[model samples]
Target: MPQHFLLSAEARNLSPIAIARMSEYEAVMTMKKLRWGEGKDVICPRCGKKHEAYYIKSRKQWQCKECNYRFSVTAGTLFAHHKLPLRDILFACSLYVNAAKGISALQIARDLNVQYKTAFVLLHKIKEALKVHKQRETMQLSGVVHMDATYVHSSQKPKNKKSERVDRRLKQHENPLKRAILVIRDSFAKQDDEQNTKQIGARNTIAFIAKSENSKVVNQLANKHITKGSTIHTDESPAYDNLIYFHDLKRVNHQKEYRSDAGVTNNLAESYFSRFKRMYYGQVHKMNNTYLYEYANEIAYREDTRRLSNGVIFNDVVSKCLTSLPSDDWRGYWQGNKKRVETLAA
Candidate 1:
């Protein structure tokens, strides 16, 4: 039998050990190349210009010709004011993208020999960077789109004394921290002309957080992400009933069967939830509601880029981090400057 793609030698291109062995100068040069490209021009973070900057060799910074602002390679980027070595930062990011399910801050701390707080803040900064990068590259999804919502923090454990436990299924007893992650995935079939067969899966994915899978929020997100007139497959959920007004909607009654006689199914979206659930249960044991959207989006990213080699994924993630602006949300996250409220759609 043919071997699975993920287990194949071709998919194992990156090594965290190699990244760890990189010299300080090598890490610095790599970041500079990723941030500014191979050209001589370095954009001034202060003035936002691509003009030439005076490279201060002694200080390892560039002074903007127009603004005279001295900035290091990470200045004004997601790693601004970073305390960790460049090599360690790169190694941490490598480990992050290499994890198929997810990596917790505890795991990062153990791997990098850093404090738990530092690892927590560092991982969150990477998450924030990925979220922004996804937003910056937003495009309308076309073709077969599958959308579904999975609830997090929705279930409560039963009391040891069964008599003392209330009916948790009731709306009044539901966990108030509960939130839904709505994932919209665009799938496509690549025709193998030689074999006259097709390969199918989700090509792109977009995720959002909402209080619940209500019609208003579902319609709003579908309209914003999926292209008009695209064929959307969903399960038998009333929230998706309204999507038919603007696009072609197909439904599979999951309670009765996984697929309909007409081949209607929401397997694409369900596949995303499968990996997300693994991340939730296997890696991140608990997820706070405030930053749940970022976690959801991170899984969406992993699903979309699953076919790429680890090396490619690492470089892509590092590039996005370098291009992302400094994050205020994670700057002083452990301090009193936490996000005041959860980000949710109506």
Candidate 2:
């Protein structure tokens, strides 16, 4: 078949489903390249002058003529100062983007044949970039927003063993697990006037955090992402007792029954946390308290967007990663590889 004729025939025979699938497939193949040729001149890093640069593919380094500045494409990128292969970085990124739950740094290191520390750093950088993008793009949680809390404790011994001894006794007085607040919007709430009972489906979580389940954090998150007058459902936690001050709070006293005054319950959020806890324990095994928020957000983001195409997720992550780069460098790098990256990620 002629090339154009074959292309046209393919398009003609494509169903709506097939076309959508093809678009996703096209996105998954996108790749980003800095410069194409061996002798292409690049601007000097220090002098800001154009100079003939030679790319040594074997060493993956470039030598500039103007200032004798020698650097690799990985220089200044998230992969900079790392000894891992460029291919490994790319593969890890692909794995992170595609994994439904998430792969641990240990698993990544084992797969890539890199040190555990390298994988840890890479994951942190990627998570930071993801968080940056998420904060930049504000998403509103509408309808019934379920609010609840869970606990995650670190096994690391406290610096003060004396205090730890006291804390152990304190734990006997209270919950042993560290507190983690979970707020999820039931995106599947449907009003039924005829039956007078709203049907609630599986929720798509908006935000999940390991912060204190106190009123302050709850109120702050509510004020930030949730719109005013949205129905907020939760258990009879003292923190959420005052939720009515900012939102239409519906309380479900689990002790008596699981239904609130507004006929709502936090079963969805509870289920979400249950699954989240299992995944965290199963995959990550251990997460530092310092980076808990990033880790939680990463899991939540992946879960919420699991149904999305790998290419779409890849582009989303890449855009975020690019934003973390210097403005000039971002523009230059993106201009060169945006189409290619999109093609691969699509």
Candidate 3:
């Protein structure tokens, strides 16, 4: 529970040389070392066969002596089809993993010296890898827990004269904005986790960006993320009424009192909501629902790993980048993709 040891100035695994390599060609070698291992058999991504491959220096690619399929160091993976340098990719990973509150795409663009569009895609790609790897992890909340649903306003605004006129027409309907999110965090969730312990603590959370907070949706979220027989503290929203069937539901009526007889409250949800909202307003001023949900997942991931060192997080994200597949789901995220965000989803 002490401040994550790895983030301390002396505890970080990143060295001056490594940081220097992040801006040089050595970062590509670092990627290859982490992804394929040093001095090992070359495995063809296309054929899944081991062959002695030769480096085609002119192309900055590899040639499988067997299939003759030529590829760059980042091909056939999450970083495929990228136009940026290899070191810059690793540089972005370092910035993202250690960012406690969260970093903006604009900030990322400035750091990488790339266009906003490239940074947008790059940040999401890293988040997508982290998200894919996190989904493989099984987390269940137990003991006292807090659950709540809140609507966050979108940051999208008009950029041109024509769009400005259209925004004026729709201003009346943008009150509650685009998405509703559900946050599930343990009330006694730890601000930090014990590194050697195997238990997933209360502060750990799972969330979803939802469209509707109906009975079935709320019930399904409760059933999936929370343990079978735990206490659920929430406000008097009717959306949570159906949760009584399984959870020991405790309600706090904000209109009259903040706490009930047994010290029941949704304080954790309020705190988390404030932080997430702040992150949204400060870092991501304009975002669509799919990426917003991805941002929520990033917040949860940050909290869950808060107790660990930044070095640990950096290594974890690097591993995810090498192993996880590229996400095709980001199509139209900022370009008018209006499909309903996942429902009854964890």
Query: Which candidate ranks first by TM-score, i.e. highest?
Result: 1
Off by over 4 Å in 1: 51-54, 190-199
- RMSD to true structure for each model, in Å: 2.5, 11.9, 5.5
Estimate the TM-score for candidate 1. Answer: 0.93
lDDT winner between candidates 1 and 3: 1
Which pairs clash in the backbone of model 2?
27-344, 27-345, 27-346, 28-344, 28-346, 29-344, 30-343, 30-344, 30-345, 311-345
List clash counts for every candidate, in order.
0, 10, 2
Error of 3 at 267 (Å): 3.5
Give the candidate order by descending lDDT: 1, 3, 2
Please state the error at residue 42 of candidate 3 in Å.
4.6
Stretches of model 2 off by over 4 angstroms after superposition: 1-76, 154-177, 186-211, 257-263, 326-346
Model 3 stretches astray by more than 4 angstroms = 1-11, 15-17, 20-25, 37-39, 50-60, 65-68, 136-138, 154-176, 187-203, 255-261, 329-346
Q: How do the predictions measure up, each by TM-score?
A: 0.93, 0.64, 0.77
Q: Tens digit of lDDT per residue, candidate 1, span 1-346?
A: 9787899999999899998999877787788888888977898888899977888876768899898889999998989999999999999999999899999999999999999999999998888888898878867998888899989889888899978999988999998888889989887667758868565788899888998999999988887888999999999889899999889999999889999999998888898899999999999898889889889989999998898899888888888889998877877878867877776766
In angstroms, the error of model 1 at 265 is 1.1
